[model samples]
Target chain A: MSAMSDDDRRAWAYLAAVAEPPCAPLIALAARYGAVETARMIKARKLPAGNAAVLTATQARCETDSASTDLETAHRRGARLVTPEDDEWPGWALLALDQASTSVRGGGPLALWVRGPANLGDASAVAVGLVGSRAATSYGTHVAGRLASGLADQGASVVSGGAYGIDGAAHRGALATGGRTMAVLACGIDRDYPSGHARLLEEIGDHGLVVSEYPPGTTAAKHRFLTRNRLVAALSAALVVVEAGRRSGAANTAAWARNLGRPLGAVPGPITSAMSVGCHQMIADGQAALVIDAPSVLALVEASGHDNFVRSPATPIDGLPPDQFEVIEALPAHGGLRVEEIAFSAGKPVAAVLTALAVLEVKGLVDGSSGVWRLAESW
Target chain B: MSAMSDDDRRAWAYLAAVAEPPCAPLIALAARYGAVETARMIKARKLPAGNAAVLTATQARCETDSASTDLETAHRRGARLVTPEDDEWPGWALLALDQASTSVRGGGPLALWVRGPANLGDASAVAVGLVGSRAATSYGTHVAGRLASGLADQGASVVSGGAYGIDGAAHRGALATGGRTMAVLACGIDRDYPSGHARLLEEIGDHGLVVSEYPPGTTAAKHRFLTRNRLVAALSAALVVVEAGRRSGAANTAAWARNLGRPLGAVPGPITSAMSVGCHQMIADGQAALVIDAPSVLALVEASGHDNFVRSPATPIDGLPPDQFEVIEALPAHGGLRVEEIAFSAGKPVAAVLTALAVLEVKGLVDGSSGVWRLAESW
Candidate 1:
C-alpha cells in the first residue's frame, strides 16, 4: 500500500535465506559489506560461518518462490533494513540481544524485519514482557492476565512471543484493557508458527504488530523459541515471569533477563505447585521482586528508573502530613491496643489522640474497633 | 530420703501463692537484698525499683517453685539456687530473660525448679527448643521428629514446654533415640495440667526432669501458657518452629526467642497450608532461617557458637583435584550433563571424564541419569 525502497527489498530478500540466529551476526556482516558482497565472500570462501544465513534466505525463497515474481517484486514489499545500531532500532532491545551467543565474529542481528508503527524498543514508551510456561496452569493464566491488564491500564504496552498459555493471556489482557501489545514471533510475520494461535496473532498484528528476525515465509523450530525469548527480554525494561516450572522455558528467559541486570518480577504461588518453583527460587535468590499486584509491579519498575512509569495514589493521604503517621504507628501488630494506651505511647493528649484517630479513621489511616485501633486497609 | 531445712519448707510455702513468671521478679528481688531479705524488698516494691539481685533470685524461683521446704529440703531434693552469675548457669539463656517486656519489664525469671545430674543451664551443652502448633499435621510431626532425633543423635539436649503436637513429638523423638530432654512446665511439677499425657509427663520426670515455677498444689492457668513460652525461649540457645499458622502461638515463642537475640529456625512448608503461614512469613521477613534439615538448624546455631555440630557427607571427597571438580561443575541445577561434555569442558579426555563422573557419582556429588548428569540435591 506504500512506496518501498529497492535496497530495503533486496535486504529483505537476503534475510529470507538465513535459517539461523546470530542472525544478528550475518546481518551485521551484511551491513558492513552488503548482503550480496557477504554472500559472494561466503560462497567463495566456502565458510560455514555464513552457511546458516544463506540457507535461511534460500528457504524463504523456496517458500515464497512464485510470490516474488521478479527482482522488482522485492522492492514493493514495504520492508526495510533495520540493524541493531539503526537510529530507528530500539536501543532497549539490545539488552536482550546482548545476552545471546553473539556471532563468534563481531556481527550481531543479521537484520531485523520489524514492521510496526510503534517503535518496538522505545524506552519512553513503557513496555513489559510477560512470559511463562506454555503448559501453564489456570493459575498462571489468571496471574498473567491480571498483571498484563494492570500494566496496560497504566498505559504501558505489553510484549510477548505469540505462544500458548502465558503469552496469549498477556496479549489478551492488554487488548481487553484497550491497550497496545506486540507479539514477537519466532517464525516469519507471514507464518504463525503454532498455527493454533493464528487468530490471536492476527488480531495482535491488526492492533499492534507481529515482528520477527526471519524474513517472510520462514518456519519456526524449538531452537527458535529460545532465540525468540531474547527479543521478548530486550524489548522491555522489566520482564515479569508470571508462572514457570523448574524446567520451563520461562526460566531461560528469566536467566537472560537477570544476566542483563534488568528488573525482574515473579509472582509467589503455593509452594507445592511445580510452576511456582522457578519463581520461588528466583525470589529466594534475590533475582526477582515478589510482585503481587499491578501497582506493585509498576512501582518496582518505576523505582528502578527502568521505564520511567509513574504512579500517584490519588487520595488525601498521598499529600498527608508526617504528623498523620502517628495514628498508623499507634496501631498494634496484634490487632489494637486501648486508646489510652496508644495516646500515652504517642505522647499526645487524650483529646488530641482521639481527634487524630477520628481524622485518620475518616481518611482510612486507622481502623478504630471499639476502643482499640488498627491499621487501615490502604496497604 | 534426704535432710530437710526449715528455709526450704518456707520457700515452698511462699512459692505456693505466686506463679512461675512473677516468681522471677520475686526471686530476683529477694536475691538482691541478700537471701530472702532482698527478695522481699523486690516483692514489696512490686512495680518500683529494688535490689538488682531480685532480678536473679526472682527469675530462679519463677523457674520452679522453691520445693516448699527449707534449704535442707531443697538440698534433699537435689536442687539448689542457680543464680544468674552461677558458673553452671547458661549465659545464652540469660540473653532471653533480659527482654521479657518492652516499655514494661519482660525477661526476668524469678527462679527455676531445676533437678538434673547435668547443670540444667550448662553453656557447654547445646539445647534447642522445638515449639509449634498443638494441632500438627503429619508433615509437621515427621519434620519435628526427624529434626529432634537428629539433634539428639548429635548429643544435643532437647528442651521443650512439653505441650502437645510438636513439643510432644520432639520429646518422643529424643526418648526413642535414647537422648536427654527437659520439660519446663507452667503448673506445679507434681500436677500434670493435660491429664491425657500424665503418664508420659511422669516418665519424662523420671527419665529426665520436670520443672515448674508454681509451687506445690498450684494449678495451670491460661496466663501461665504465656509465661511458659519465656522459659522455653530462655532455656535454649536457639528455638525452631516446626509448624506454625498465621497468628500461631508458636510465633509468639519465636518472637520471644528473637527478642532475646537467639537464632531461630523455621521449617518451610507448602504455602497453601494455613499451618505453614507463620513460618513462611518468618522466613520471608528474615526473622527465621529456612531450615529443611537438621544440618541447616545445626549450621546456624553452631555459627553463633551454640554447638559445634557438623554433618559431613556420607562419602567425603576431601580436597579433590581439578579433574574431579570438572565432573561436579558440569551437572545441571538438578540433573547431570554427559560425562563427555563435562570432561570436554574440563579439557580432559573421555576416559578421565567417565572416571571422574563414576567417582563423584558414587560419592553423591554427581548423579548419572541416562547419559546426563545432575547434582544430587539442590540444597
Candidate 2:
C-alpha cells in the first residue's frame, strides 16, 4: 500500500480532533473526498456536494487547528499518530465497528494515538480483552491475574483498560510473564488517566503497546471511557469479563463485544459476592459463556470451528464401581474411620462396605493399616 | 381414581422388591397387564406373549416373595404403599420417565412407600428439587438453604435426596420457615440411611413427606442413590444443583432433570473451590441455567410461559448521566472525599465533578455538608 502523505496525516488528525468520536458524518466525508480534501473543504466552510451533516458534526471544533501542535506533543511523549492511512492501522480488527448497528454507540475512531514497540495490528489479531470493575474483590483480581498470565504464555496478547483492580492485575500478570499486553486508555496515550498506574502504563509502553483514540492533552471523562470501551472490544478477537458490579463500565464493553459479534465469556465468582452480580446475570441471560480459566477463554475464541474443550478434571476413582466410589467418598479427606462408620456414612450395608474397602485397599486407594480405613495419601 | 385393593398393594410391594429399580421391562409388564396380574405371572415363571426380559430382570428375587411381610413391616412403621391404582399416586409427575430417552437411566418406580401428612400428588404438582454435594462448603449450604426457604415460602414444596450437607440444609431451611418439604430417600421409607438425620426425617414425615421406592427393610447403596435421583427430578417441576464436586451425585440428578424435560438451574460459586466445579461446568455447557436466588429458580419452573425474570437489583444512581454516575462510583462506600479527590478518582474535571455533586445533592443521593461529599446513608 502507498504511504500516507504528510498533508493527509495532518488532515486526518484535524478531523479526529474536530469531532467527538463516532461521528459517522465526518467519517463518510473523509471516505468520499479523502482526508486532505475533506479538511480543506471544512476549513473553508465549503460543502462537498450533499454533506451538510459533516458541517454540523464538526461545527464546534472545526475552527481550532491543533493538528500540528497535537502531533508535536505526541512526538515529545514518544507517541505517534496512527491514521487510517498508516499501514500499521488495525483496519481488519476495527472493521466490525463499521458494520455495527446504531444501538451500539461509538463508531470507529478517526485516528488512533499509539505508544510502544508492539504492533497494534499484530497484537490485536490474536488478543483477548480482559475488562472488569475497578472495585474488584481479591478473588476477582486473583483470577484475572492467573487468566491473563496463562493467556500470555499461550502466545495471545492480553488487552485491558488501564484502571485499578482487575485491569491493573491483568496488565501486571502479562508483564510478569514477559509477554505482550495492550493498554487502551480512556484519555490521551501520553497521559495516565488513573495516575496511580502511571509507572505501569510506562512499563506497558516500553514492552507492549498503549493506545487510544483521544489526542494529546485530552483528559479522561465518563463519556470518553464509554467511547474507549468500543476500541478494546474491537481490537480483541474475543472478550472476557473477569468481574463486574451491577453497574460497571466493563458491562458496557461486554455489550460492545456482543454488538461486534465477538465471542464473550464471564468468569463466575461466589454467588454471595456483590462484585459478581453482573457476571452471573450475563451467564444466566445467555449473554456470555461461563469461563473459568484461560483454556475456556481460548475455547470461546476458537469455538466456531474447533472441537469441544472439556473442563472436568479426572479423579482417582473415576471409573470405580458405585460401591467402591461411595466408600472412597465416605472416607474423610484427613484421618480415618472404622468399617461400620464408613458403612453408615456411605449408607451401604456393612458387607458391601467391607467388600468395597477390600477392593479399594488392593487398588491402593485406601489404607486399613491403623485398623481404620482412610483415603490413600496420594488421593 | 379408584383406591388400590390390599391385594394390589401387596402385588406392587412384591414387584418393587423383585427387581433392581429402573426395570423398564417390569414397568412395561405392569402397564400392559395390571400390577397384581404381573406379580402372579412373575411368580408362576410364566411369560406373556413374547415378553422374556422380565425373567432376566427378576430372576434372583421373584421366588422370594416378601409382599405380606414387607407390607406388615411398612404398616408398623407408619409407611403406606401407594400404587398407580391409588388416587394419591403422582402418576402425572412420573409419566415423564416413561417417555424419557434410554440414555437417561432409570424408569418409573412400580410403587412408592410414603409416610407423611402431605398428599404426594398435590405436593409434587408444585415442587422444586434441590440437590448438591454432601461435602458442600458453607457458601453452598447457605445459598441452598436460602433458595429452599424462598421456594418453600412461595407455596412450592422443596424436594431433596435427604442426605447431608446441601440436602440437609435445604430440608432444614424449608422446615425452619414452616414450609412443606419432601425427602425422597434412597433407602426404605421406614429406615434412616443417614441415621444422623433420623429426627429430621421424622419431623419431615410429620409435617411434609418422606418418600421411597425401596421396601421397608431395604438399605441405601450407591446405585440406589443414582436410581433415586431420577425420582427427585421426576417429582419436581424443576431441579437446581446448589453445589457439586466433579463427580457428584447432584450432576446425575441434573442430567435426569434435563432428560425429563424439567428446567434445570445451577448456583455459581467461587472458581477456586472444587465444590463448584460441576456446577460451573454445567452452566458453561448450557446444560443448566445459572440461578442465584429462588426467583431465578421459579423463573426456570415457569420458563415455558411467563415474562422474563430479571435479576439485576437497581442502585440509586441507575438513571444518572455518565458524569454523575461516575462521580457516585468514585465515592468510597464509607466516609467522604474532597471535591478534588473525587474529581481525580472519577477522572473528570473539577468543574464537571462539582456540577455532578450539586445535582446529586439535590437528588438526596449525596451529602456535601462539610466540604466533603459522601453517598447518602439511604443509598
In TM-score terms, candidate 2 sits at 0.76
Docking tier of model 1: it is incorrect
Each model's DockQ? 0.07, 0.59
**Interface RMSD for each of the candidates:** 4.6, 0.6
List the candidate 2 regions with Cα displacement exceeding 4 Å: A1-8, A31-34, A101-105, A304-379, B1-5, B27-41, B46-51, B101-105, B305-379
lDDT of 1 by residue, A1-379 (tens): 2244555445445543533565544554454455555555544544344346554544443333232432333234433445543566564446334323442311234556654455555622577889888888787888788888888888778888888989899989988887778888887776766889988876776677677776565688787777777667666668898888888888877876665555788766654467877776676666777666677777767876645221132344433433454445546666787777676555345677788888888876778765678777666
Instruction: Report, to 2 decimal places, the DockQ of model 2.
Output: 0.59
> Once superposed on the true structure, which residue ranges of model 1 sit more than 4 Å away at CA?
A1-6, A9-19, A23-89, A93-212, A215-225, A240-250, A265-280, A290-296, A308-379, B1-89, B99-104, B114-227, B239-251, B265-284, B306-379
Score residue B329 of candidate 2 by CA lDDT.
76
* Candidate 2 colliding pairs: none
